[model samples]
Target: MAEVKLKNLTKRWGDFVGVDNQSLNIKDQEFLVLLGPSGCGKTTTMRMIAGLEDPTGGEIWIGDRKVNDDLPKDRDVAMVFQNYGLYPHMTIFDNIAYPLKVRGTPKDETRPRVEKAAEQVELTQFLDRKPKALSGGQRQRVALARAIVRTPKVFLMDEPLSNLDAKLRVTMRAELKHLSRALQITTVYVTHDQIEAMTLADRVAVMKHGIIQQLGTPDEIYNDPANLFVAGFIGSPAMNLINGSVRDGMFVTTGGTRLTKLPTADRARAILGVRADDMSVHEAGQGDIDVTIYAFENTGESTLLTVQWGKQRVIARGDRHLRKEQDDVVGISLDPDHLYLFDPDTEQRIRM
Candidate 1:
């Protein structure tokens, strides 16, 4: 395993800058994920590290050696792409053994290593199957097995599960996490799916517009986002960003609802951030705000409630069994400790 580091890494295509000056340190054996929406420079960043794309500026280091000028094959890294790039004519065993063969490993030694990798990915039974014969998930497993067989210093995956069905994707997610832990390879995975990043990464780098907005563990990024963008982006229902003003140590929404009375310390902030899960619903009179329920979506264990206070809508998550219907008047309570404050001018987080 090797530690990978990127210092002021940047990439551009003509007038458009795909990746801005971005720097990151990935520790040895760490699972780091690059997460953001489409056109956010995530794949561009990954391609640079994999040597598929050259950076216009900055340096890349694998372990202690600067690898910015190194060829992809010489970088000692294995990459698994989204499309599961397998040779259609080759059998699963031959596909897995191709890297070892290209590197000139003895034929006797290559067989056991290929079989071992296939076993690790539960593809040992299908060793003789061609890419045409395997299912989508199985083809991906072959790709993964091929990457694993190389035993490279670092593993880079760019949304390798995107093509799989939902159920298969979940299974592969768990398998990939386990395989990474077992192999202890330094991994850098890129994806736009927040759930994949949250579940698979030891640390996640949330990016937007070619820049990292936040870098933290799943819980930290979800519970304490660094800015309004992050708070609004990382969650399922997303965080509720109510437009309210602080006046006389209290928070008041535009519709005459007093949601929270902040401490002197928190009162100075201009905006508040609250997560959907942190807010609870009740009858209109007892809580801080009266909202007309716009909709309620039942999501297995919990229900996502969309409530409108005047013209603005906010979501709150609660137990699915707790029933509330459309157009029902409900009271909403905001948990102050869970609330995040942001500066209106900078759109950055403000300490309470």
Candidate 2:
């Protein structure tokens, strides 16, 4: 049982707070991701778990032991950094074997473990080559092999695919998913990429300014966001937010055009949220409201239309065969079942 628990964890540098009082439980053999942008304290939280940084307050536990006072090497955790962190002078085999050797494993036992780890990462043939001769993806596998050779209690990965190119990153994402399930190690991963968090994590903790804004599965976060920040940050093109108000059981644009039926009884001011895909396009005068087209984009799988409504512009996801031009006119209707209402002042979702 390698469950991890952070109890009111915090990191403070004098007046600056890197990680506020945050508590979380990561279950055994679960793949958990800490997701947020830079300076959001995701990395700081992981470092505290790894024993690389001391917490200003709270307790760090691994299984039955409190590990706040333990050294990084004594914590029995493996970390993979963004830069690959391979030795330039040593061969790939030696690089992967370094961890085992430093821990005083016998030479005879080290060879089979190193070889098995290398084979798992598809680096067996390149074991004799130096780091300078390998590609970005190959060097990354060397780092992974080094970590897997020792069978640590927990895995801490910090943006391991950020250094790779876009195409390579996609391929590596699949590989990492496969490897994680095969090893079944309790893992804590930190990344700013939403796609990575959605695809890799069993549960994601989304943070901002040192506070966790929401924690849920990918589908829960995407389909039903807790707040404006979460709804805006999770989607690809983002959810479209229209400034409007509720009046007489209907939502009216600031321009006084009645757009759709109001879910709530009546609120003087509110924000209507809908994703591009939830909106349907039609010929002018046929839908809820007619608007002039601002721009049109074709992305192969689907087309996107940026339509002008009142003083605001909202994007609508159109069919792949859709063909429109700037200055053209079109009508957009919001799906009633998928629409969201939020209080403008508090930025929280309105249940009604």
Give the Cα error of residue 275 in candidate 1, in Å. 1.1
TM-score of 1: 0.96
Q: What C-alpha lDDT do the candidate models reach, one value each?
A: 0.89, 0.92
Candidate 2 lDDT tens digits, 1-352: 3999999999998998989999999999999999988999999999999988999999999988999999999989998989988989999999999999999999999999999999999999999999999999999999999989999999999999999999999999999999999999999999999999999999999888888888898888888888888888888898999889999989887878898997587988988889999999898888788989999999999999999888888999988998999999988888998888888999988876
Regions of model 1 farther than 4 Å from truth: 264-269
Each candidate structure's TM-score, on Cα atoms with residue i matched to residue i, is 0.96, 0.96
lDDT of 1 by residue, 1-352 (tens): 8999999999988989888999999999999999999899999999988899999999999999899999998999998989999999999999999999999999999999999999999999999989999999999999999999988999999999999999999999999999998999999999998999999999999999899999999988988899988888898888877777778778776665677877645344466788898998777776677788899888888988898866678899877787878998888888778988787779998766
- Which residue runs of candidate 2 sit more than 4 Å off their true CA positions? none
Show the lowest summed lDDT stretch of 10 residues, model 2. Answer: 227-236
Clashes of each: 0, 0
What CA RMSD would candidate 1 show?
Answer: 1.6
